[model samples]
Structures are given as structure tokens and as C-alpha cells.
Target: MAIVREKGAMRQWSRSQRQCGQRIALVPTMGFLHQGHLSLVAEARLRADKVVVSIYVNPGQFAPGEDLDVYPRDFDSDVEKLKPLGVDIIFNPHDLYVRESPEKNRESGHETWIRVENLERPLCGGSRPLFFRGVATVVSKLLNIVEPDVVVFGKKDYQQWRVLARMVRDLDFGVEVIGCPLVREADGLAMSSRNVRLTATERKNALAIFHSLKRAEELVRSGETDSSVLIEQAVTAISNAGGKVDYASIVDQETLKSVDKITKPSVFAITAWFGSVRLLDNVELSNN
Candidate 1:
């Protein structure tokens, strides 16, 4: 597979593929590939004639004091993992946003940002205020650079998928945003790059997050539809698991607004801290 490092090169590659009448699907990723990521790549492979996976650890998405400095990264290993997956090109841009000034906490020439407004104000958005702004801006850059027929995102980041999907529609990006099912380990922990940072004990405790969501799913299936009751149970589970709860709420899967009752399609999402690692996972709920 070809590795593309420059935005101009990527756009040229895209133009050539389009000229050849080849449909392309772009899978955006922050390296340190796991089965969850591969699953998205696999889906992309099936959807288009060519697939481009962009490996970027966006600094814009990380807030002050967040884990941007030490987020897990092994470019060589990530490349190896994708080699067997039939990826046509790996768009590893060196830097998309460049700051003219090098002063700390000083404004750079980069002043533009994209926001989904109401969609980014709940769940993970509530805690990490700057998270979605960074995500939206960088993803907008990727969509512009790659210009693929479709882009794939894992629903594991439920809020993120919704935010970007909405952004595409509102901004008229013209690329199909596909949300793949959230992948999980055999024991049910949502696969994440940060899973490597968890200590043995913390990893075992992390199962509580998924388990609680599963139990909540069971309750919803058994005629429990109250959002308050479900959210309370998720919070208590994380607390008892020795993990700190970031946010747990059942929101409409599309609008992302919290529902008073689970009368329609909704998602029970959770973000919790296991030791220093913050992990996200969610389960979709539907009464029908």
C-alpha cells in the first residue's frame, strides 16, 4: 500500500482515482490500530473500489492537560497491521494545521474551526469542551484533503459519529459518512488504543463499564424505559468498579439529545476513567 504524507499528494491521488471512475472510501484513524479500527477498514474495502486510511493523532482534539503528549503510537506496527488489510493508500499527513508562531498559549495563524453546536454539547462534549471542536475541524480538513466518495467511522464514538455525520450534511461535504457497528473484545470491553495503558487490575475493573451497559440494555428490553433510572444505574456501576464516571446518559441516537423516555431509537453511552485512561463505549437501545 502507498503511504501518502502530503495533502497535495493525497488530493492528487484522489483526483487520479476519480478520473479513473474509481469509488474511494476514507477511514480516518488515530494510529495504534486495534481490531475495532480494522473492522472499519474492512467495511471501507467492501464499500468502494479504493480505500484510504488516514492515520493522524490530531493535537487539536486534545484539551489542556489531556493525554495528547503520550497517546499510544507505533507507526511501524500500525502500518504492518494495515498491510494485510488491502488498504490502497495510508494518508499520514505530517501536519495539516501549522502555526505561524511558536509561542505557547499564543494564537497562531490558524483561526478557523467547525462545530456541530447542539450535537456536541452533551455526553463526551459536556466534559471535554474542546474535544468536538478539534475533532470537527480536523475531520473537515481530512474530508477536504481526501475528497473520497465515502468516509467510515466506528459507532463506538457514538457522539463523534453523530457530530461528523451532522457536519457533513449541514456543510454539504458531499461524502457519504458511514457509521459501522462498535466492535468489542471477547470479554466485552470496547477496543481502544488507550486500552494498552490500563494496568492489569484496572483492565479487569474496566469490564464493569460494558457490563453495566449490558445490564441496562437488559432492563430496557424488559420494559424499563426511564432515562433517569438507566443513567443512575450506569453511574453506580462505574463508581463500584473503582472507575470514575465521566458521563452516562441515554440520548436519541440521531439528534443526541437526551430522551425523557426510550420510546424511539436511543443509545446508552458511557465514558469513564480507569486509572488514567479514559475509555468510551455505548449500546444502542430500541423498544421494538
Candidate 2:
């Protein structure tokens, strides 16, 4: 696959595709090749004539003290993985975030930011206040730069998927955003790049995140609808397994507001810190 890094070249190549009437699909990622990422590419293969996967660990999306420096990187390995997947192009931009103004901040010199209000107030956003601002801004940059016909995101990052969907609608980007299913490991833990950082024992304990979500699902399916009860059980499960709970919540899938019962399709999502690694997982609750 050809690696397009410079903005000028990327725009030129994408424009050529548009002129040739080629349908482009993009899988935007912070590099550290995983099955979950490849799953999105598989779907993109079916959806478009050309698949462009951009592998740039966005600095804008990271919080001030987060693991931006040591997150993960294996560009060569990532390229090897994508070659077999029929990925036509890999847009590895050195810097997707350009300075809009001269005002410099901790993360960037640009003061311009894209904020998705309401959706950013809960879940991951509640903790990482500037996250979706970083996320929305970079995604808006990529969507504008790549100008792909479609972009694929994993449902594992359920809130992120929803946030970007709302951003696309609100901004009228005209690119189809597709949410693929959450991919998992054999042991039931959601596959994440950070999984490599876990100690063997911590990895075992990390399974509790998934287990707790399942337990909450069971609680909802069995006639328990109280949000407090669900949160209590989830927190207890993760804590017993040695992982500290950041947040365990059940909320309306679309609105993301906490719900009292499974009156509508909802999401059971959790974020926890296992050792130095923070992990997140979610399960769906739908009426029968």
C-alpha cells in the first residue's frame, strides 16, 4: 500500500479518487494494529471501492497527563497488517492538527476546537473534559482532509461513535459514519492497544470489566431497572477483581442520559483503571 504523509499529496490523491468516481472508505486509528481495527477494514472492503486507513496517534485527543508519549507505535507492523487487507492507501499524516490561531496551549498552538455539546458531558467525556473536543477537531480535520465517502468506527467506543455521528450531522460533512460490532479477545476482554501494557495477572483481572457489563445486562434482563443498583453491582464486580472503577453507567443509547430502566435500548458502559492501564467496555440492552 502507498503511504501518503504530506497534506498536499494526500489531498491530491483523494481528489484523483473523487475525479475517477471511486468510492473511498476510511478507518481512522491511533496506531497499534489490533483485530478490532482490522475488523473495521474488513467492513470497509465490502462498502467501498478503495479503503484508506489513517494511522496517526492524535495528540489533540489526549488529556494533559494521559499516556500520549508512550501509548503505542508499530508503523511497520501496522503496514504489514494492512497490506494483506487490500487497504489501498495509508494516510499517515505527521500532523493532522494545524494551528488555527497564534494562541498556544498545552496540547496545541491552535485555539480553534470542535466541541460536541451535551454528548460530551457524560461517560468518557465526564472524566476527560477536553477529549471529544480533541476527538471532534481531529476527526473533522481527517474527514475534511481525507474526504472519504465513508468512515468506519468500532462500537466498542460506543460513546465516541455517537459523538462523531452527531458531529457529522451537525456539521454536514456528507461522509457516512458506520459503527461496526465490538471485537473481543478469547477471554472476553475487549481488544485494545493498551492490553499489551498489562501484566499477565492484570490482564486476567481486566476481564472483570467485561464480566461486570454482562452482570449489569443480566440485572436489566431480569427485571431490575434501577440505575443505582446497576451501578452498584458493576462497581462491586470490578472492585472485587482488583480493578478500580472510574465509572460504570447505564444510559440511553442515543441521548447518553442515565436511565432508570430499560424502557428503551440502552448501553451499559464502564471505564476502569487496571494497574497503569485504563480499559473500557459496554453491552447493549434492548427490549424484547
Candidate 3:
């Protein structure tokens, strides 16, 4: 894969590709890739003539005390994993928003931010207030930089995927936002880059998050539709397995509001903490 670190050069390559009439597929990531991330790359390969995956750890989404400092970075290893996939380009830009003076950001008024508004009020946003704005902004930057015909985001980050999809629509980004299905480990823990930080026991306990979601799916299949009842069951299961529940909610997949009954298809989503690591997972349910 040809690695382009600067945004201008990346855009030039994208322009050249467009001139040649090659469709570009982009998979944006924060490096330290895993099988789940690679799955997105594989999906992109099937969807477009040229695949471009970006590996930049965005600072905008991180909070003051979050795991931003140690978020994980192995660019060399990440490239090795992408090599076999026949990826065409890697846009590893250092900064999407460059400040003339580093010290000015602390004192200067924030100039720009992209907010999905109501879509971010629940789930991850409840605790991480600045999360979506950073995500929307950085993703908007990437969408502009790569200017791909299609962009792929994993469904594991259901909220992020939805936020970016909405951003693309509202802003008329002219790029297709494709949400791929979530992948998991054999024990059901949704694969994550942070899974490496989980101690042996914590890793095992982490399975509770997925199992609890699975239980909710089983309940739905068995004709249970009350959202509160499902949330209670999920909370109990995760607690028993040693996870602290952040939120166990069943919401309308589109609106993201808690639904009283599963009259139509819905999403059962949860976020729990095992030690300092926060994990999220969700399952989709529909009558059909």
C-alpha cells in the first residue's frame, strides 16, 4: 500500500484516482487494528476498485481523563496487517486541524465543531459529553480529505456509525456511509483495540457484556418485547458477570429513544465498565 501522511498529498492521490474513474472506498480508524477492523477493510475491497484506510488517533474525541494518552499505536504492525488485503493507500495524516500557535487553542475560542445534536444525547454521550462533536468533526475532515465515494464504519460503534451517517446526510457530504456488522471473539466479547489492556480475568469478565446482549436477543425471540423488562434482565446478567452497567437500553434503532414495546425492529445496546476499560455492544431485533 502507498502510505501518504500529508492531507494535501492524500487529496492529490484521490483526485488522480477519480480522474482514472476508480471508485474509492475508505475505512477510517485509530490504528492498532484487530480482526474486526480488518473485516471492514475486506468489506471495502469487495465494494470498490481502490481501498484507502486511515490510521490517525483523533485527539478531538478524547476527554481530559480518558485513555487518550495510552490509546495504543502500532502503525508498523497495522500496515503489515493491511498489506495482504491489497489496500491501495493509507492516509495517516498528523493533524486534520492545524493551529498556528499551539498555546492559542487553550485561550482562543473554539472555531468549528460538527454536532449531530439529539442523536448523541443518549448512550455514550451521557458520560462523555464532548464525544460526538469530536467524532463528527474529525470524520467530516476525513470525508473531505479522502473524498471517497464510500466510507465504511463498523457497527460495533453503533452510535458513532449513526452519528457519521447522519452527518453525511445533513451536510450533503456526497459519500456513502456503509455500516458493517459487528464481529466478536469466540467468547462473544466484541473485538476492540482496548481488549489488549484487559487483564486475563477482566477479559474473561468482559464476555458478560455480549452474553447479556445475547440474553436480550433470546428474550426477544421468545416474544418478550417490553423494553424495561429486557433492560433489567441485561443489567442483572452483566452485574452477575462482574461488569458495572453504564446503560442497558432498548431503543428505536432510528430515533434512539427508549421504546416501551418492540412494536418494530429495535436495538438493545449496553455499555459497561470492567475496571477502567469501558466496553459497548448491541444487537438488532426485528419481527421479520
Count of clashes, each model:
0, 0, 0
| Cα-based lDDT at residue 42, candidate 3 | 96
What stretches of model 3 exceed 4 Å from their correct place? 102-110
RMSD of each: 1.8, 2.5, 1.6
| Candidate 2 ranges beyond 4 A from true positions | 99-108
Candidate of highest lDDT? 1
Cα deviation at 198, candidate 1, in Å, is 0.5
Kindly list the per-residue Cα lDDT of model 2 for residues 136-224, writing each as its tens digit: 89888888888999999999999999999999999999899999999999989999999999999999999988887888778777888
Give the per-residue lDDT of model 3 (tens digit) for 134-227.
9999999998889999999999999889888988999999899899999998878899998988989999988988887888888888988788
Model 3 C-alpha lDDT versus the unseen true structure: 0.90
The CA lDDT at 120 in model 1 is 88
| lDDT values, one for every candidate | 0.94, 0.90, 0.90
lDDT of 1 by residue, 1-288 (tens): 999999999999999999999999999999999999999999999999999999999999998899999899999999999999999999999968875765655566688999889998999888898899999999999999999999999999999999999999999998999999999999999999999999999999999999999998899889998989988988998999899998888889898888989999999999999999999999999988
Instruction: Quote the lDDT for 36 in model 1.
Output: 95
Ten residues in sequence with the least summed lDDT for candidate 3? 102-111
Q: Model 1 lDDT vs. the true structure?
A: 0.94
